[model samples]
Structure formats: C-alpha cells, structure tokens
Target: MVNNILPFDDSDLTKMITRQINRSWNFSSKVEDKLSTELKDLIRQMLEPDANKRPTITKVLRHPWLRDTSGVTGISLTAKTSNVVGKKK
Candidate 1:
C-alpha cells in the first residue's frame, strides 16, 4: 500500500520469496517521503521479523496513530439497532 505496488516484482518471484524467507524485504526508500512517520512505524511493527515481538491487535488498536481520531468523523451505530435492522428506513 505504501509503495502503491508490490515490494517484490513477479518477474523475480523466486528471489523475492528467498528475500521474504530471509526477512530481508522492505519498503522502497521512495516511500519514506510519501508516508508519515507514524504510518511507517506502524508498518514496521506489523512486519516485525519476530512474531512474538509484533504488536497485538489490542495494542495496535490503541496505538497513538489509531487512538488519535481527531478530525475524523463517523456515525455511531451502537444505539441505532432499529436503523441497522432497516426499521427506521
């Protein structure tokens, strides 16, 4: 998503697979300026080489980036059971 393309090319599938297995694959340098630091950090955490060191779903949800919902607006459906059931429409 960051690069708007796959990190590895289809023509080099074998080499790409080898790099993935070796945990040597990474986003291109070009993406550094294109993505935010927080986003890059989150991506790095998600792609941690060690599974045990990766952030849990809960942790990810609570990350500063996700927690800061300022400027974002959306409808709250918790109290709109009738609307969800098509009763209000």
Candidate 2:
C-alpha cells in the first residue's frame, strides 16, 4: 500500500530503509547501554527493503518482546487474533 501511495523505487526504498534503521538504533541507544551485536544485525536485516534481503516473519517472531504472552491484556481481541493468525502463517 505504501509502495502504491509513494513514488518510490529501489533507490528510494534503500533511503527509507536506512532512515528507519537509524531511527530505531537512535531510540534503542538512548534507552540502553548498547545493542547486542545480534540485535544490531537483525535490525539491519529487518530494515532491508529488498524483496530477498529482508528478514522473514518467523525471524521477527524471535524478538524478545514476542516471547512473553502473560499480563498483557491491554490489547483488543481482534488485534490479538490478527497477531496470532499472522504468526501461524
């Protein structure tokens, strides 16, 4: 949908990827002592826009926040169901 809405091609995609990676890194850096090497690299892969180079959904599932499922009842059931369904596929 964003691709359709924006007049972006491969080069623009790369710039957006770079900007997102930098933004994430900056935010993480402010809150933590340092990013683990693995997370830094994974974030790089996550921001990759190339159809082949981006991380898979399952790879993203391994993120630390997703490992915990208890005590987070703030989200709606519909959102939860969509999250579950997205992981299943």
Candidate 3:
C-alpha cells in the first residue's frame, strides 16, 4: 500500500513564505546599524504575492546594501601574489 500526503494549502504556504521573508528582515532589523525605512518597505513590497507592488531589481540595487557595499563586502585578508593585488583572495 502507498500513502500520499496532500501538499500544503495556500494559506499555509503563504504563511511559510512570509515567515521566511520576514526572517531575513527581522535579522537585519536587529543590527545596530542604519537600516532605512525605505529598505524595510521595499522588502515588504518585494515579498508581496501581487507583483504590482514589487520593486524592480534596479530599485532594489539602489538600496544601501548595494549602493554602499564597503561595509558588507566580505574581502578576505590574506597575502597572495597575483597580477591583481588588491582583489579579495
């Protein structure tokens, strides 16, 4: 005999999706740093199921994370000999 379980319902799936999206925001929100209300609002917009409310990649790229990547750029500090010296190793 085979047993099958029905897939999650729409409301359940939406709740799961929103929880995942909000997890990212909730994490960033806790940081003692500058997190613009616009950025938070943009995240909300992007996470919306209705595409009309979503922001374009270009608009999201304009966010502080990309616009000011210096703070978050994960450049490893190691001495390596290469033609390109300053690049992250």
Candidate 4:
C-alpha cells in the first residue's frame, strides 16, 4: 500500500479533501528515496483525479511492479486478512 504512507494525510478533514481534490501533496524525500521509478509511476497513474485517466484493475494487475508475483501466494489475514475473506458481499 505504497509503504502505508498517505500523501494527503492531514488533521483537518477539509484540508485533506482539498489536498485530494487538488492532488497537491508530494511524497516526502524519505519516502521518495525509498520508492522505485516503476512504483512511483504506478502510484501517480492510480492517483489521477479523473476516473477516465486512472488505470483499470486489469491494467493495474499488469503493471511491471505488480506483475512480480514471486513469493506472493493467495492473500490471507495473518494467513487469515479481514475475516471477510470468501464472505458473500
């Protein structure tokens, strides 16, 4: 989840909405330093405010960074996630 860092994080709800609306937050130097180019690019694409500009689930799944499935098995929550796995929506 992008290092679990929230670029739009703010204590003020309105400010957080504004930041998300404007897409104005930049990753901090430390976070930027830790990200690879491919991952950064993917995050930017996913963050596009315009829904039409955003990548589809298929496209996201096909991204070079995500395509690396090594050591990644089916998701689990503690080999268990949300206790809602396989639950009917």
Candidate 5:
C-alpha cells in the first residue's frame, strides 16, 4: 500500500515474475509523497539481498516505524469501540 502499486508490477505475468526475482524494487518519484523515513529505512533493510543482513522478525516488529504508531493511529481503538457500543445501545 506504500505507493498503491505492487513490487515489480507489470502487465506480463512472466516479466513481473522475472523482475521480482532478478531486480531491486524501486519507485518513480524523486521522493516518496506519503511514506516516513523510518518506514523507508525499514523496508530497505528488509529488502536486503543478503539474508544475514536482514533484520530478524523480532527486530522488524520492534522497529520504530511499527512500534511508534501514534502518528498513524490518530483515534485510539478504545474510543472507536466505545462509539460503536453507544450506537448499538
């Protein structure tokens, strides 16, 4: 969902698969319009070709981009739950 396009997206199935296996992922814009730097960094690390260099699952989950989500979650889930309950009653 980062750019509303899948990695190595193409009309030809074979070409798309080939690119996925052989090419590094990329974006069109000079700078991403919506993604944060932290997120971009995490994606880059995760995309590293060397498995030894990629972060562990725990590290990935603990990354600041995922751990600190206050910027993305404007309304707390608790508040949303309460609103839904009130409507039901």
Candidate 6:
C-alpha cells in the first residue's frame, strides 16, 4: 500500500532484502506520518519476524483497528471449522 504512494526504488531491493533477513526493517517516514497509530501498530505486529510472537489470524481479527464493533464479530466460526476439518488426518 505504501508502494502506491511512495514507490520503492529497484536499487533498494537488495538493502530491503538484507534488512528483512536481519529483522531490522525500517518503514518509510511517509507511511508513519500518513497512517493511523492503530494501523501502524497492527502492521508492526503482523510484520514480527518471530512466528511465535506474531499475531495469529484470529488475534489479528480481534485487533481494535480491524474489529467490527457493530454487533459483528470479525472472525467467522465457519472458517475455524473448515480449518479444523482440513487438518483431520
């Protein structure tokens, strides 16, 4: 999404990949200035390099920034059920 606004230079791809490998990504200042705090927090949580520390899909659905408070739960039980069914051996 940030790429839509401030495009990344092809020359920066190597540096970006290196940073990702090192788990030291730096978001563009323009993104920080333009996006909301909640959105930024969510993005950060989603980008966590440690799989154990990263938010689960269900947890992400419950995030304040993404949750729908109008009597509608963001997570669907059917999706959960499907996942369980698919995992059955």
Find the candidate with the highest lDDT and give its number. Answer: 4
1-72 per-residue lDDT for model 5 (tens digits): 675566666789887767655656775464475778898888887766568888976577667887675757
Model 6 per-residue lDDT tens digits across residues 1-89: 85244223447898766665566755677566777677778877887767899998767767877653456667665566557555746
Better of 2 and 3 by lDDT: 2
TM-score each candidate. 0.59, 0.37, 0.35, 0.64, 0.57, 0.55
Model 4 poorest ten-residue lDDT run: 76-85
What C-alpha lDDT do the candidate models reach, one value each? 0.68, 0.52, 0.47, 0.74, 0.69, 0.66
Model 6 has an lDDT value of 0.66
Model 4 score (lDDT): 0.74
The Cα RMSD in angstroms, rounded to one decimal, for candidate 2 relative to the true structure is 8.4
Q: Where is the poorest 10-residue window by lDDT in model 2?
A: 1-10
Ranking by TM-score: 4, 1, 5, 6, 2, 3
> Runs in model 2 with CA error above 4 Å?
1-33, 63-89
- Clashing residue pairs, candidate 1? none
Give candidate 1's root-mean-square deviation (CA, Å): 7.2
Off by over 4 Å in 4: 68-89
Instruction: Count backbone clashes in candidate 3.
Output: 0
**Sorted on lDDT, highest at the top, how do the candidates line up?**
4, 5, 1, 6, 2, 3
Instruction: Indicate whether candidate 2 or candidate 6 has the larger TM-score.
Output: 6
> C-alpha displacement of 3 in model 5, angstroms?
2.4
Backbone clashes under 3 angstroms, per model: 0, 0, 0, 3, 0, 0
What lDDT would candidate 2 get against the real structure? 0.52
Stretches > 4 Å off in candidate 3: 1-11, 14-39, 70-89
Which candidate leads the pack in TM-score? 4
